[model samples]
Target: MNLKNLAAAALFAAGSALASLGVPHAAFAETTKLKVGYLPVGVYSYFWRAQDAGYFADENLEVELVPMAGGGQIIPALQSGALQFGISDALGVLNARKGGLPVTYVSFNFSQSSDNPVHAVLTTNPDIKSPKDLEGKAVATNLSYNTDWTMMREWLRKNDVDIDKVTFREIPFPDMLPALRNDTVAAVGAVEPFVTFGKEQGANVLGHYFTDVKSPVVLSGIVAMLPYVEENPDIVKGFVKAVNRAIEDFKADPAVARETIGAHTKIPATAIEAMNLGDWETEVPPSEMQFWVDAAEKEGILNETDDLNSLVWSPKE
Candidate 1:
């Protein structure tokens, strides 16, 4: 062959090698590094699932999942730019907005379902049979003014229990079981797999607080600062797509969900298997935010409410 013909053959071979290696000519060469904050709980397993299942990578994203204590820390981290994204409860997001911190929900995380309840009021004391029994008792929650705290208070009130008579303590989820076992707290607002683990340690479920009030309540979801979301809409869209894909995969296979959750959390296999996971969803409706807003206003948690639609960030087509 002539030199020009030989060069043409080499170029053809180079293109074939690139195609064989699955390398696109116009590939997304840059990956957006995202520091994502999350509460290390079984319900937020989809974050780990998305990372482990390569959904985030598929979107050209490098997600660093930072395990946070609760929304209390996560919200501030988001505000200060320490975290680009975070998973926070609806109440936390709304409260932050109420306080003039421009944070908004970008995608759904998980919901509390009647069929598969994850959050509950648990007690180890045999004498504490009902909510009214804890008139002068202290109850542990992950944080004050959080979803669990708010719901448990509402649960107590619904049962005709005096709100002022009960005292709430802020304790992490892992420590709640020990606190209950040693009688440090009369009861705990437990989320799984602690709910299941607590039962294994002799704690009994007083009631499913979240589901008792309403079935399929929007619990928490992906959140970010409004400025970040507005400036980087594509990044936000990619994140939403990745998380939603992960949710679908998580729902399709229970075993995979268990494995993914167990890998991220310290829960034992038995507890993970026995525990009911949250109902993960992909969409966050304005009505769901309204539920929390109305509840917060009634409880005097929020003095005034904002338009629910403004609190959520919807991706433009």
Candidate 2:
């Protein structure tokens, strides 16, 4: 073959090899602009910290932060395929899964669930003391039978208070304080941003329940629709890796949390110190989901999760 023909033949073979190897052509591109939902609160430091520091950008992820009233409502959005990803309390994910909401947690966001570590039980009437004091009284939470209720049950058990003795109500964290002032509920179980706000309103801090039974409760964590996961598997992997990076960033310098205050949550820089944002490790310990299963089961909230194992998923290490 002449030099010109030989060169053309070599170029054709090279192009064919590249195409057969599944490598994208120069024109091929990844889907851009992800729609990620988050509750309007300060404890979601990892999500905010990640966005603030451009960790998502570094990973080639362009996340659109969509704010919702609370993580509980994120289920419907996820179910209808309106959201690509979001952070949700573990209970929300479990309950939604049972309800066939088509979502699951990809990583642990808040590692601990003591009522006080990142949240609080508030009572405006200082006369009330202990979980037993909640008897015959109404209480409010941003969501019912989810985080606060789970936390309340743990606190009640810890304080030797009967869970059946109290009347529980649902109120948004923003509305919880107002409900407390209006006598809608005697006390309100609240977490971050709201915890600080509730306390500032002269609401007495009754008790804090971080874990279900003094065990780590995986409160708010990241979950995604399985279809979305299957559609963009790399997005899921990149997102999780980026979260670990964000957590490391926050763990090393908590100052970034202050910057996230206005964007992710309404709380100020001064309040960030008081709230406990656990270590930013991406691991969702298999033991963590146990806290939710045990708590929800014992509290009579496990209507759909009779078998704990069925409701749990441990990502491969």
Candidate 3:
């Protein structure tokens, strides 16, 4: 199913109107307008909350959240300056920097918590009990050389499954169901809502892949060009401030999340209501980041010559 469907203003307005959703206000004397691209999925509830609660405005940021289909277009938009900032996975940012995109991750969007998993490996075949069972099988991933692919490889290797033996098929999240049903791919690496939806459709969940590899896995976050960040550190701070506030708003009330996610993704109310939303935070430790960078390097998604420091941006207190 297509995660993003154009929705009306009322859904967005719902967050701002809710009385229980409250966070400290950020004040800036000068307003800076920013155009940001986001996936418009439940994973990006913080972005919608930031917009819905006027946190961006409080931080003197007139933000425009451009709806993006996936990571494929987000970085390119940032590179060409079409977007001042965009949400993308760690591996995408690492590979982009390896390809000379000059981008750095500025904030954390979501990560794998013990209570909630952002991704899972699903199979229609019940015989495939473990990663090793799918030794020579074709697995579907949304992107051929992305964070999910890297994580899948690592998770497989840990299970003694030969990484070189498995064939990966690139399929969009929406088409994964059909692909699995038609036996196009033996298994699919699916993210939230889809994981739940896949289960609802009778697909056997192998396990939450991230948890199988490592706990507290950092999945994705906000990113922007390094040069832009250095030149306008305050803007970065303002944006991050808004994100932090949005995180609190989400934690404060469950209804705010339901409304914001429903507004942006247009996923069915039942799915949205039942979806396991992971932790939304602004801090991703360097050690946690090293795991993805190492995975990217091992997967050849990043060049050995690439420097890790340039690929990340941490705000100063």
Candidate 4:
């Protein structure tokens, strides 16, 4: 089904579920309205789950989950006050901070670990057996300087592959598989659902790039402008609490998670069922932030370092 139809179905399902729970729509006398921007992907199922299950309502929040194309679009919207909050990769958030955007991560979202690797380097070429084999070949990522691209570059670098010799192409997640199939790109740095899709299409995984760098690294999280967070600390805390509740629900019920994911993302049920959903965390540790900080410095993405503590938002006692 198309994305629009799937989204409609998801909303209908959410409404039905909420109705069955006997939760009236006007239960709360005072509700904080929020516009949260996020990329439409399976990993972001927590947002949909939270909204659908009345977790946000339980926190007295009326959230409008805005589906965005990428961080590029989301970041600008957040800056222009079009969105109150946005979900972004750790790298993107750090980069934004370096560029002087007062955004801080309010809560962690998705994580990648060695045991449950959710991101992979997939290639259809028979001769490309390892990372080194792609030294002179082209690889596709959703975007340059994105989490996938940075992790893939680090993985290739650690594997003794000359990354300078490798050509990087920015193909959207949905287009990566076709790019690989047609040999438009030698390989693709793909995340879940797409990783499962690529394997189903006979593509071989060269490696789980993110895990290769470090097991259990924070990939992305929910971010908000510092000013908004400071002014509305209660709203930020409520958002984190609601999402944390949803994350717990997501972990406890895999079937419902898949259904919610399939309804929101364009991935088919078969691939969604097969894909590894990876890990979710409510807390974004300072060490995890430092890992990206060190990485950015090494990659010359950041010249001056910033305080890691300041990058994350916490409620004042």
User: Which portions of model 2 show Cα errors greater than 4 Å?
Assistant: 1-31, 113-116, 262-266, 303-317
Model 3: pairs clashing at backbone N, Cα or C within 3 Å: 1-174
lDDT scores of the candidates, listed in order: 0.86, 0.70, 0.80, 0.86
Candidate 4 segments whose C-alpha is farther than 4 A from its true place:
1-28
Model 2 RMSD in Å is 5.5
Task: Give lDDT tens digits, candidate 3, residues 110-189.
Answer: 77766788688999987888888888899988987778887788788888989788998899888898899998989999
The TM-score measured for candidate 2 stands at 0.80
TM-score of each model, in listed order: 0.90, 0.80, 0.85, 0.89
How do the residues 1-317 of candidate 1 rate in per-residue lDDT, one tens digit apiece? 99999998887777778878997642434798999998777778888988998999988899999988778889999989999999888889878988999888898558878889998899989999999998999988888887888898888998999989998999988798889988899999988888888788778889999999889798788889999999999999998899899889877887888999778777778888999987787876767788888888887889886777778888888
* lDDT tens digits by residue: candidate 2, 1-317: 99999998887777678878975442233446778888655566677777778788767788888888656667788777788788788778777866776676777656554433666788888779766888778877666778677777677678877767877787877788888888888888777667776776688888776553564556667778877776777778878887888777766776675566656555675666666655445665656677677767776766655343333333344
Give the TM-score ranking, best first.
Answer: 1, 4, 3, 2
Candidate 3 stretches greater than 4 Å from native: 1-30, 303-309
- Superposed on all Cα atoms, the candidates' RMSDs to the truth, in angstroms, are 4.5, 5.5, 10.0, 9.2
User: lDDT of model 2 at residue 103?
Assistant: 71
List runs of model 1 lying over 4 Å from the truth.
Answer: 1-26
